[model samples]
Target chain A: MTNNTEGRSAFISGGSRGIGKAIAIGLAKSGSNIAINYTRDKEAAQETVAEIEALGKIAKAYQGNVADFEDCQRMVNSALNDLGEISILINNAGVASRGSLITDTNPEEIRKVIGIHVFGTHNLCHLLVPQMRAAERGDVIMISSVATESLSGRGAPYNMAKSAQEAIAFTLAKEEKVHDIRVNIVGPGLVETDMGKRLVKATRGVEDIRELDKGSPFQRVCQPEDIADAVVFFCSEDAAYVTGQRLYVNGGSF
Target chain B: MGELDGRKALVTGGSRGIGRAIVRRLASEGADVVINYHSNQKAAEEIASEVRKLGKKAEIIMADVSDQSEAERLATESITALGSIDILVNNAGIGATAVGRPHVATASPDDFYRLMAAHAFASHDLCRMIVPQMRESTRGDVVMISSIAAQSFGPTGGTYAAAKAAMEAVAYSLAKEERGNNIHVNIVAPGLIETDMAEMMVKFQGRVKDSINELAADSPFGRLGYPEDIAGSVAFLCSERASYITNQRITVAGS
Candidate 1:
């Protein structure tokens, strides 16, 4: 599109790889600076920063576990210091489920999944919305999953966390609209990513993730760039009037 | 070139307000257009001329969508004029409150049915008339121009809100039913926009309490929405960029 994102800054969690990295690149392509958060994977996070720098945009990486409230506060404050007044916030850090039914899933695994997806999303919004309001404009996005709608019996933890995340986004959309902040959810289905590969290997016993792409009407799995495009649209001037919406990037698949 | 390089579209209520803006935006994006208007032939023709100026084909048809048979006729005429209908925007409706002030207790039953026929029934009729044609295309889009009133549930806007809510529910169901055919059904719900419809609401509210200017001041953005604001969102949804997006409700209402 256009370089309308110039002078804007964004903070995205889990920006080391997969969908988050693609979003970082997409925003940078539109001329926005980035502050990326990663729980571990310092090497991958650094590589993301390098890629953004290669594209002539400023970027830096921070270490934090978004599930912990204190870590979120620290990362957000540091990101503001690094990138100056964050205009966009993406709560994307998450862990995939172990594909256990509700009764069979371990309590600790459930807690971890909920902690990362639900609490992590709230923590970032709680920390960043005030500054966004002070500035009088901002965009917040939650990376949810189409699993919420499919309600796969084996994905209870992931479904519970993602469904909860969407509810939070809807409520915040109403609450933040008065302040000129737009909140939205981008729910991708069966995207070809590291997590998608892992899920397929565990569930379908397949090594190649591309095999899961067959059933979509489009005859392909969703790519990280596909989801990234939706995020960029929601963060763009074109979406100024759009808020509290959940866009499903599922390639016409159920 | 634009996103809708070879697409053809039909927009109901294209004479004025948000519908007119959608017609303009789609034309600007390189889509040939057919617009349906109930009574404002002058305004409809004017928009058609503007669309032609954008180097696109444009036609204006006269049909009151609130009539089921008339809506079907309009759909038939739209396809005839445009050659194919790749995009259908359900934007026509009786002005939101021509039915009268909002209290359910005081609201007339006839007014409720009239509003329902104008908003929900008209959309349902048009969707049924056009989906078969849409299925023949490689990609098809249907956008329901709803209202935030459906979600807000304001006391005075019960009939209007109920009609919009029913339309949204229908849109969601249609999204599921039509996904296999590659037809995307979505909703665009605009908040308080600056239009003749909003002006009417202001005048009706004036008798009860506030002035028109106060209504403008109500948005968190410090102003009412321009027609282009809603049109921009609709244009995005109609583009290929939104192929992966379906069964969604986007509100063009600023916070």
Candidate 2:
């Protein structure tokens, strides 16, 4: 295996911890200067940078909410300022909640989820895409969910939002082909991470959900690093000529 | 410039063997590779170290592919993390006889069907949902891996073969339907590979008699295909190099 991030730079959103943090570290380990974006985890973000620097690769923490468009733009611009142009963007930042049933959910809460899950993702693409097109080569990946397909319940708003984000990703991949930017989606099943554990708890409350799991006969749930590995592959050359596709990274849990 | 210089690919079930070889191959060519596994984040990290040695960026992901909701989440999250997905390798599959339709005569029917649906049919379901995007943008290619079992017929191999066959038919029909659109869809039906699954098949009930190399040499190629060998074929199909190839099955067997 060869590490080519040597001269490359990558800027990823929601990259401070969890799957994002793992991906940042992986890229740094591969030799790319990394720009880690986080909403409020300053210390965690710095720690991620420290890890990247430890790898002898340059890393900078870019603070911003993954919920705001302006923040997304600023985050991208700042990363470019520090590391030239980003060759890849891993959209790993996302949020999950304990609330269920949209009828009982607050409107503000819905906005929070949609803003970070969808809009924040959009903001970065809007700014970074043009530069990638100009370069005639770039990759755009959207961190999606199995909820969009398994839409079991109360995941309604979240599912719709992710579906919309996927729409934008496909649209960009289709339209941007003239410039050669590839747009794709990565779908992962349950992982053992904070986000995944939260879901396991949310639905494990239901008999059918638990039964569904056993019925599937899957192995261990999964981990953040698992999802990050998928990210690294999507950004790699092996996937060249692969565009406008969604890669599901679940164990046999499907 | 290969359409993938700045591109990224996330291959689930990618690790030592086919997945690992895929990571090395992709990274060697210039695109970054993210190696994913179910339990071995350490192995994933080690694979990361290997990919790093190539100067190509690599990441490790532990997301399980079967959890439907998580499936969508992971896909979206990855798309966000990398700017785009030029290739999607739905290589994440499990080989299981424990939960299968083995024609055991005593095995429960449900176990048989579920086994096929989970491993063989699932990836197509993924492509069914994910390929429209690929179609919408640049030229898209989906390489679904199937075993010679997909059509081997009858008895203990019932469920696995049926499910794989179903997926391949789906891939072939879809390939034919989308051929005009330039969305290339193909299948690599590996008769005998060095994977554990192959080893198990060879040992199962004397189904494959002879040593691994003895069986491998049975193929027209005079040797068994390695993961890297198959990886090369897959990468080519996804490259501009195979622009004219679509809707076909390329069987790798030694003569």
Candidate 3:
């Protein structure tokens, strides 16, 4: 494994399962200690902690809803206290959009989706950036989606939230460049995860998640490992000079 | 130790400029490379010698990438010589200034076609020929060298920008099409790099080094991008660390 991230510590929101969990494991393999933030599912979060500890790295799990600004501060403070000077912060906690179209979707549903994705990302970056900036070696990553580039009619709330998240990332990248902090976004396409499963069920009304896999040239759904790898790359020394970039781990789908 | 050790790479236009840097960088990281050139066998051979000094295998092939038959032949020959191609970098193309500055009305239609053939068609043909063999490998990567002109083009820069835009479009499609096959495709778009091509562009614009440097100073990095800057990003994309990264475009512009 690349030692690019060795001796670093990362705070990954929603690291209990799915793409977030995979990123935690990937970072662990790169020799970084991990602080995982999960809203619920203590059992799953503990499982992740055990796996990281087995890898001979310090691991801790914090319960917090990132959508709430106060909870974000609590999570970041807890992570700093547990892990010491957090160098990497990944905004990965997100909720799937329920409504397919803007007109048909309830305003409350749109608010919820935006609250978790946009507000959650803003909360984490707002609270944790000061410490990261002080460290002089920092990485702030936003987990976005390829849907921002899509012209598809459906999934309006999801697309809007992701677009806003990317805007924030790009803006931070420029604003934080003087501080030697690298800010970027990793946008993943359809992956075989809990969110992916829900996305398929909601969008295509398909009970079998396999249906979405057929559209991909690879004839399979994107693995969470794929997204994790991209996230790790962004955090690694290999990308030290790469800033204000958006890397999509969509396996070639637009 | 380099992260790309034991990999076999083929870089088109690997004789000089960004392609040469990529070839050298990959070799330093433990990958054997095939350097492809159109009419610069001497330069290609020189780079090959340099790669060999890095303790990796290096071979040179002469082929006009824009020509379908030549590109197809090069792919087949490269695979046979290197056993397999784990990474392919499509970096061969004509300079935007080569056709001279002319509006669409006065511009030769043939020039636009030539640009398309060199930038877009060549990449497509090579990917078609090489992807099958690449799929057989555990990890495969393809990097297309595009330009920032694709995003912002001047009046006379239409052909070059259009061709690059088309190349990017192809890259995006190929990325989705080949993801299931365990192949990762990406684009590296450079902005105002200090290369021979950039030199020609500067001369065409009647711009001197002082003016260019002033422009560079205004950029985030306070300088023009170097070939190595682009090469380093390509190297990262080719490594196992970038395994989950596919269908992405990383612009190596200073800003």
Highest lDDT scorer: 1
lDDT of 3 by residue, B139-226 (tens): 8999999998897787888889989999999888988788777888999998887777787778778876544554565555455777
DockQ of 3: 0.36
DockQ of each: 0.46, 0.01, 0.36
Cα deviation of B211 in candidate 2 (Å)? 43
TM-score leader:
1
Q: Write the per-residue lDDT of candidate 2 for residues A1-254, one digit (tens) a residue.
A: 32244666788788888778888887777667888888787998899888888889889998888777777777787888988878777776788754578777777777887888788777878888888766535778888876677876677667767887888887877777556666778776665566665665676653233334443212234456666655665565544445666665553212
Model 1, span A150-234: residue lDDT tens: 9888889999999999999999988888788889889898778899888878888989987765666455677888888888888
Docking class of 2: incorrect
lDDT of 2: 0.67
Clashing pairs in 1: A177-B255, A178-B255, B102-B156
> Which run of 10 residues does model 2 chain A get worst, by summed lDDT?
A211-220
Rank the candidate models, highest lDDT first. 1, 3, 2
TM-score for each candidate, following the candidate numbering = 0.90, 0.53, 0.85
TM-score of 1: 0.90
Best-fitting candidate, measured by DockQ?
1
